[model samples]
Target: MVFWILISFVALAMAALLGLILLRAHSMAEPPAAYDLRVYRQQLSDVDKDLLRGVINDSDAQRVRTEVSRRILAADAQLQKQSSGSPQPKGMSRLTVVLAAALLIGGTLALYSLLGAPGYGDMGLASRIEASDNYARTRPKQAEAESKVPPQPNPNLEPGYADLVAQLRQTAGERPDDAQGQALLAQHEANLGNFIAAYQAKQNYIRIMSGDLEPQDYGELAELMIMAAGGYVSPEAEELLDDTLRLDPRNGPARYYYGLLQGQLDRPDIAFRVWVDTLRQGPKGAPWINGIEAQIEDMAFRAGIEYSPISPPGAAGAQAPALAGPNAEDLEAAQEMTAEDRQEMIRGMVARLSDRLATEGGSAPEWAQLIGALGVLGEQDRAKAIYAEAKTRFADDTEALAQLESAASMAGLEP
Candidate 1:
């Protein structure tokens, strides 16, 4: 009863307001603005004063006075008509206003009755959420299908890479004692982003090379493990990364991957700092710089910092020194040229380097450079041949053997 009483009062109040508007509209039928008569008479007086002062010419004053006189006459006529009490018609007819008000109220309520939950009670926030939850529970299959789909394998892997992987697996299986073969398989798998096989091959290689391990070896294993876990650096990988940094604090790949792990763990602050420092220390021509630079921009955005990365410390003159021993200008020029021209230039340079190594006998670093250049150019077969030749040439020198072997291993050359 109280609810019905309140609704009745609201309806009555709205009707009363509408009636008042119609009444006022009726009163404004004549729109009594006869004040315009007084304004026009004042303008006529001003024009006469201007004529007496000779401020405006007599002809101009006469025209202004005539216009003001004409407005005065129109206002006087309107005022006289308003005061005549002849029952002037209103601008809006009374019946039309009544019908319009009725239709507005009725149409609004009718639309609400048609579209709204007229019979249902109000649903608060909690009730709405609970209703959604009930809907989800009612369709278990749909919810399951929509909310959880099995992850798929990487679609971007090269088809030929899988064949290489099969051959690599066969070799590793047939020669379990061939750790070097396993190491090469690991690198090739990693390059192809087949991190699961890469991790397995790296595990085998690490076990065999336990006595001859370096920080780089541990870092490689950590990276493979991280990739196998789909970018999540697991606790096992973290331990490997720690071991890598313990042996060598400035390992670029290890540190970069460590930063990635930090980002994955929701520590953008730590990731940003690590990557910024690593970028500063690394050469601009480093292969990983491009990836790091892209990642660092995202990190900076999430960390809410406007970061402008400076070129690595030693890239002052032309370009950062290439790891493959190309001069700064050559590498910079490669970036500026067309792809075909760049390839031709690179082939020429590689040929020259190869010719020099074959005839004059350059340093171990030079041989490593040629092999690395071959790797970058996707000539892994040629790189493997170069690695074999460099091994024989550096057989008497342990340091030279280590450097050349490291380069060859990076290029995916088997022992």
Candidate 2:
């Protein structure tokens, strides 16, 4: 929207400038002074010649010559006054010619600056223009994707989160060592309102970034782990994201995901800075920047923290501590787990959660996951009641409340 707005403004400004130039040029093209007088005198001469040849009456020729003489005298007097004028101001003396040329060139440049070049992508004018055009073309698809975003989790999941847990167990079994697959499983768990499982999977994904993985692959893994951190305020998850960024400072995905996680943590100032830095580094009109900015704005609005219009005044981004934590160590351990063991473990954990939620009802630690599963399973009323109960029951535990709220939001269940 901002990009299109800017383009419209530029187009209007260019049209206005062109109109002004045409108007000025028209004003400068006044009728010539001496030419009109000269033509009148020539006509008078022809009348006199006709009279001498007895072609016209004497009175008519005399009257025409008098008017022609009067016009000639008026033209001469005006010319003499113009020629006799005092010198122009010193600033404009020989500078008139220079100033006129300067005005023409400078006006063109000023107009171009205001309306032609958009300072985007840290690119040259031509490059910026091209990129802006390209972004414009793709923006509609991006907007539609945003608009059509699934309302939280799909509404076919069931309560006690049995279906979600089952889905994750199945997927984990299918792709035990796949970082992306595990990350997707983790995200689905998160969408199912299972923060613990999400946190576990995210930790596992982060832990596996090791000697075998390329820097780029590590960066991608870091991004998913950071993104999954939004499900829980795990100090471990935070540390992992911070560490990933430290290892790959310029990874756009890692930076964006980290920014989002920061926002989730209600660190608007930090999130804003990270997003601003991302915008500075990436190509102009980058979709990531828009997404990050939107997240930051939403976070700031929710937290009632005023986001600085200007980014944080610093060269450095979010700072991380030197030491790794237990979760990080656990991730490292998970990386060493045999694929079969990992699959069996996740399956057992999901089954345990399902059993606990079914027996213990909404008071269980895994109730939210059940609610999410229930929401997906088309138990809309049950999910809403469960979410409302969780929100009220766990009101004292901000983390629990937040998790419940997140689940409700994803489930599209009113709280």
Candidate 3:
């Protein structure tokens, strides 16, 4: 009787345990709770009352009642089973103990293989997440800490001429064929008054462009070359102006500059021609045109030529003070020469200038000056040819080469 009573008690405990497990599993399998079970029960009661009062149809009442009853019975069954202790471990037989030990060892090994070290994977993930959150919350402070180190300028720089020369030399070395590099080197040399070096660099840059230089580059190059000339006229520079005009005849800047170059070369006739051309092509009241007009008037006056000048009325509204006619000195300078003689002189000059530039090895800026001098001397053909050859050779150097071509063309030479 005692053994039977013990068996019965054990069976009851197993049933209760089984019921508790089923109840817990069922609860876990449901969707996560959005509201209390008590609220659900209250809703059910309200619906039941509505049906009883005929506020809802019989069919709806039936469906609602059936669902509620099913859930309640399932809950009751789960609770009863949990209380009965339905689950119990097998007896402590030798075979049972061996199997249990084997399971325990296998489970530990499986967990280690599948999940890595117990606190180094998922556990580590949680730690990382916490750290990331902390970092996000203090991100501004972290950024401020990082920004405490101020930016630093180049260490090897001494400022002024030394730095400029060093940088230019380095840039030239690194980018041998780069026009901008050449320009920079030329700039440094010019600043140092190394005109010969500057001119050489400028010409080398122009020579590299094998006919790929653009119009804008041509205009800028002409401007720079004019500045580089330092007041000497050269056949090469005349050829550059010719090429510049050919590329973009309508470019007012090019036209105006060409006029100035012509003036320097002692070709007032051509200079005045270009200045007039600018006036016709550019806006009537444009500052560039007005400036060129002023220049033309001044030149005309110096040549003993008459032109409309802005002058104040004299006493009794008499015309403005009239200047004397061209003096012997002015006429001698402006004397007309045969085209043949002019061409011969230009040819000789170009030959000499080319030799100096090539054998003597001038700088880029000096070369620019030499080119301008050629234009002023009326060696337009030689200048144009040089610029054209440069364009053909330095196809990649658009700006410098284009300037050479434009300046040459503006001087009325074919490139």
Candidate 4:
């Protein structure tokens, strides 16, 4: 109520000032100059007196009288015209002033009431800065919590495979300088989403390489780090991506993750460009390609651009060598076991792979492995679930679907 009263008072004062201005303009119009015959008559009489007193000759007095008579006649004519002409300040009236004043105040107050903030209070500069800082400080805590939820591999794996892993662990422990053992451990650990152990094993492998690393090694290391960080490309992972790209610019994983890092660094243009190029050159079924495609569209949207990547070729791509339930040596050992033991171990292995893929999604090859394993185990329901999930995850990915389909057909599973 008090605020409204103050506004009303100020508005009234402004309206009054506008009214005064209009009235002053109307009143300030120049009034017609007063033209009277009496002044001219007085001047003519003075000239006649001067002549009578012998101050001027007759001809000079006549000339002066003629000029005075002309002035008096002109003045009389002007006064007559003025009486017939319009009144003073003819166009501007008092009503116009009132309307103008009312309009000025009414328009301003109406606009303010319509557009201005009527109830919002100011959060001063300091408070606003504090709020912004608090927001910035809170996000990492959420990310840290997510990263700490360690990935769980299935507990019920094959006893033989578990024994093999145990043997490998023993070998790696005994021969701590064995680079090959460390590398194998890293691959197996990552395959299981034991990212913490995978990271340790990869670091050991990196140390073994002694700064002589391949782009594939760097890319794999970056992947391990990102998985350990719950998919966030931290600065350390970014550096590994950088190293991967430096070694091989065509490295698919490096290019994709580098784009992600660029997006995180708020360089959407670079991110968009890198991801687009990666899509153009990448194989249709690369595990990272779907993620890259999504990120590209998102960055393009945010950068206010229209983006459409060229479709990947439909031709069959060169696939990596197949890795099934076990290697030849492990299979030979499994063949020595009793038939029931062999069947139980095979089911256990397949179950673990299924659990791993379901819990923590894997690469295209890993997905193939899980699908094939499920088919071999004759578990059609789980195989269908895996297929459905893979299809959903790689919705638009023709190459990945093709690979899974081939594996399904070979395993003689239901479509």
Candidate 5:
């Protein structure tokens, strides 16, 4: 109520000031004809003074006096015409002032009501930060977030592949001690977009590999968990992100998700800073780069920063790395070879590519190909492991991750 009273008082004061200005202007203004009349009368007086002083001969003075008198009469007539004309009605003038005042106050209040937080008081930086912290501390947990998310539809899969996934799920569930089975189930479930099941399987895999866990392990689990919760950064996922960062401070995926967590917690200032730094430290292809680009402007606005969108370095006219795969000649050669020979040839190619990547890092497409080739050769476990490593490798590269995801899908590893 006090806030309203204060705002109303200020608005009314401004409106009254405008009205006073208008009224004063109208009251003090002199007619153009009145000024002309005064000037002509002064000229006639000067003519008479000149006649008396003999500055001019009597005949010349008389002619000048006659001209000045004619001008005075014309000026007087114009002044009389102006004065006799219908004057601005006092009521109408007052109505105009009232309308202007009403518009000034009403328009300001209406615009504020539409665009401003009516009751929200101005918050200092420290107060805002404290509020954000309190909000973060009170945010929903993983289970609660997951509960609020609507059920996602499973991806369309071929019958044979669907059956295989079903069998894998059953086998992995029955063999709780089998880490390899759990890993496979996790990969396949994720590929089928069963993120909840995928994350659960990942949990089992993490438990089994607890003694040998890497940052990427926790990062992957957090990624799946976030996906399962429809991108909400749950407390569990936040903890996983913390663990990932603790192990590898520069983990791109974990850092990106952590910034997202900050945004969700009403701390866009921190989120903006984190995302800006992350965007600048680019593999330009990082999976989170697009997300950052899409959202960072809004975050900056919320953080009270004057921000222009920054494109990732090398984003303009950037080309994908040339994929390392068989050419037409190799295809033709393979067509002529015996089935066993062809299989052997493919295996030889895969081996050479694998060795090259292991010794000297290759492009993301090459890694994706190797993963897919491994899967085709009945090496699902190796494909799954390679998929994980490839994701970690191109974590910052959105385009590379997209290519890797496509290959992973084809390899029946994960989505």
Candidate 6:
């Protein structure tokens, strides 16, 4: 109310100033002929003075007087004609002033009403941060967010595949201790868009494999939980993300979701930094890279960064990075070798691949293959080291990290 009063006062004052200027100009203005008449009368007075002082002869003074009198008459006649023809419209002038003032005041108020938040008070930076923190602290829980999401439609699926999924779910429910069955159930459930069921299956899998839980397991659970809540990163999902990142600090999915959580908490500054770093360490087709590319500009704006949009790597008809791996001809030749000889050849190939990777960086799949080959050779320490390095190398590529994690598990390392 006070703000409105102040704005109204200022607008009214400006309109009043304009009205005074207009009125003063109208009142002080004189006709051109009136100025001419005044000059002519002054000249006539000078001629009379000249005659009295005997500065001019009687005839000369009389001629000057006549000429001045004729000019005065002509000027007076023009002034009277002008006055009668176009009399100052005092009422119209007042009406114009009134309209102008009304427009000024009314237009100002109307524009403000349209564009300004009428009742919202100004917030300082600290106050805004406090409010955002409060809001984040009180945001909806996992169950509440899940409840608010509308039911998703069943995906179109082949009858054979659907029946298999249903049978898998029933079997997994019956055999609660079957870790492999639960993992399969979770995978299929998530594929069917049943994320709530998927996460529940994943929870069972994690419990059954508690002794062998991996960072990918926690990341998967968090992703399912977020999907269950229609992409809301609830507290439960955040906890899972924390676990994933604690186990593997460079986990791509965990970091991406953490960035998303920051954004939801109204901390775009942190979110922007996290996403920018993640996007920079990209294998072009990573899921998080696309999500970050789509939203990073808006986040940058919110965080007050002057950012220009960037194209994703391998975009615009650019060739994808070539992945180094064994060719089909090598596989065919290995097949013809005896078991002992094949084993020898495999060790030689693995040694060569490892040397090449050490000299020049390779794709995530090639790294995973090397880890798995080391595991096959019973080199546990080397496999573990390779797995760790692979995780760090492809830290921002979620799919690549998943593959690396799978290779790590197969390598018989503790999760």
C-alpha lDDT of all candidate models, in order: 0.71, 0.55, 0.54, 0.70, 0.78, 0.79
Cα-lDDT of candidate 5: 0.78
Alpha-carbon RMSD, each predicted model: 13.4, 20.3, 29.4, 17.9, 7.7, 10.6
Whole-model lDDT, model 1 = 0.71
Superposed model 3: Cα runs more than 4 Å off? 1-162, 187-195, 261-267, 280-294, 302-305, 309-415
Instruction: Give TM per candidate.
Output: 0.47, 0.28, 0.32, 0.46, 0.73, 0.63
| Stretches of candidate 6 exceeding 4 Å from the true structure | 1-10, 32-77, 83-88, 303-305, 311-415
lDDT of 4 at 283: 77
Best by TM-score: 5
Q: Write the per-residue lDDT of candidate 3 for residues 322-398, one digit (tens) a residue.
A: 11123456345434544444444445544665776567544333344445446544455666565655555446644
lDDT for each residue of candidate 2 in 295-330, tens digit (9 for 90 to 100): 766666754677664343223212222111234454
How would you encode candidate 5's per-residue C-alpha lDDT over 1-415 as one tens digit per residue?
6667888898899988888877776666677778777888888888889888989888998898888888888878888877543345667778888999899889988988998779897677888888888877888888888898987776754323455567678777799977667776777788888888999998998898677766877898999999989999988899999999999987778888999999988888889988888887765755677788888888899888989776566452133343344667876675567656666665777787887888888778788878866865668888888889889988997768867876775455656
Query: Sort by lDDT, best first: what order?
Result: 6, 5, 1, 4, 2, 3
Candidate 6 C-alpha error for residue 219, in Å = 2.4
Weakest lDDT window of 10 consecutive positions for candidate 2: 316-325
Of 1 and 6, which scores higher on TM-score? 6
Cand. 1 TM to true fold: 0.47
Error of 5 at 56 (Å): 16
Off by over 4 Å in 4: 1-147, 150-159, 313-415
lDDT of 1 by residue, 136-184 (tens): 3443332233234345366453223344456667877898777766876
Error of 1 at 387 (Å): 7.2
lDDT: the better of candidates 1 and 5: 5
